[model samples]
Target: MTDNIDIDRSLGFTIAARNARGRLVRLGPVLESIISAHAYPPAIEKLLAEALVLTALLGATLKDDSGQMTLQAQTEGGPIDLLVCDYRGGELRGYIKFDAERLAEMPVNPTLFALFGKGYLAITFDQVATGERYQGIVPLEGATLADAAESYFAQSEQIPSLIRIGVTRDEHGCVAGGLMLQHLAEGEEGRDRIHTRLDHPEWEHVAILGSTIKIEELAQRDLPLETIVWRLFNEETEVRLLGGASLTKGCRCDVVHIRDVLSKFPAEERANMADDTGKIGVDCAFCSRIFAIPVAELENAGETTK
Candidate 1:
């Protein structure tokens, strides 16, 4: 990497610099692990990567100790009817329900319109302690995933933000990365104070600088997230780092959960999910892990699969 960024690391981080400037950057190594774990195809991988990166950036902005955020999208006539992701405590899991027949005909690289056709993006946040929920829904008019995210803030949340994401795959694996800049109040990031700067010149200047970023540069896992920020806003003063979190491939699917879900189903329905060996088996869309429950477990209570 031309920039003095440490590319060897994979932790995702956000920068809340001075002057009401904020940027969130996620690297490939963290994202690629998810790609390998899920084994999604190229087009789906790209979509998932973009959604994951966007989720991390947006989720961090509103993260709380016991709050969970979810991002979901759906369309009328697209291959995927629904795509949803849940983020909480620096962890994420997402699933896509697609029309397999239609997906088979899609190109190796499909655009948002091609994959999802026309749809809406919905973001929801819920806090465990307060039982408080916040939701913002926006039309998916933007050609890119980041564009749709930006539109959500403009039309729903009323925040001035710019999100850009890019994904690339080589022989080794897929790498997805993105950066976002938001016009928070002039105070430093993570601070209690909030300032509204309607005429701030820095927002526009940063927007122009962010626009010049190339897809290749963002996809480089060897480039540090800080290096990307420095390359874009090195001249700016009072640059501050608002701390960061690491991301990994994780899914909540396990034998106990799977058996519980099967127990809720009637015996007849459960039988349909059973294999010839009289074991109930199902695949988790989030992580592609398979859980199998034996007949004894379905009949009464039994040990779980590892």
Candidate 2:
């Protein structure tokens, strides 16, 4: 099964930045491996994997304890309504809500934004084992999801950042790959250096090289990091790899959590749920698992402690 594939060697990136150290980041062997279990449509899977990689890339930026990080995009005029994912400990779980039928007829150009008209993007950070949370919402200003995310960084952090994302499949038709690039925070001096580097003809050469990276080879788990680096940035001076983070597919679902949701119903509503059969159906949206919650069992269970 594809789930058995080791993502440790599978999902990763090799970075090359002038005047900056580069590193290989691996999101464990199981992150994408688990995500691949779901049989998502081609376009949806590509988008999902791109978002999944962002979680890993941004997760590496978290300075606090390992916690839950979520990315969401909502659009009104799009073929799709929203795309969201929650990441923690290198595992991610989420889905996209869209009209699959509508998208099949949609043109590939102008891409996702053409479908979603007006909406907002939001990111939330929740501390693991702690109730603390922080969320920021930004208007969907850019034509791309990555553009929306970059806007969030500028508005919330007041730091100039850029993110580039590419998602595509291989000839073999396996869910292939994605890439992210961001400008590190720096003062005026650092910014000057960055501008000089960007102006260099050689840097443009590297940009072309970076663009040529194939999505198929990126999915190969057995390939060495150096091989990827060389393929993308061969003969480029001062190439280096800084570091990387690993990821997997995970969901925050549990029996207790489901019960808690049921408890949100008033006592009267809970009573209304009672049928002669004494069973109420509770389904998980992500996994589509149905739990036949028993009224009698719930009554005996008492109030759930938050």
Predicted structure with the largest lDDT when compared to the true one: 1
Identify the candidate with maximal TM-score. Answer: 1
TM-score of each: 0.82, 0.70
TM-score of 1: 0.82
| Candidate 1 residue lDDT tens string, 1-306 | 233243212233333443444555554555666666754666777888788877776666654756888899989778988898877776777867787789889887767888888798999988877889989988888688789988887777556777888777765566667777777655445643223445455566767877888877777766667777778777776566665566555567778777777777777887887889998778777776777788667668523322
lDDT for model 2 comes to: 0.59
Misplaced by over 4 Å in model 2 are: 1-40, 104-110, 127-144, 147-174, 185-209, 233-244, 260-267, 274-276, 303-306
lDDT of each: 0.70, 0.59
lDDT for residue 227 in candidate 1, whole number 0-100: 74
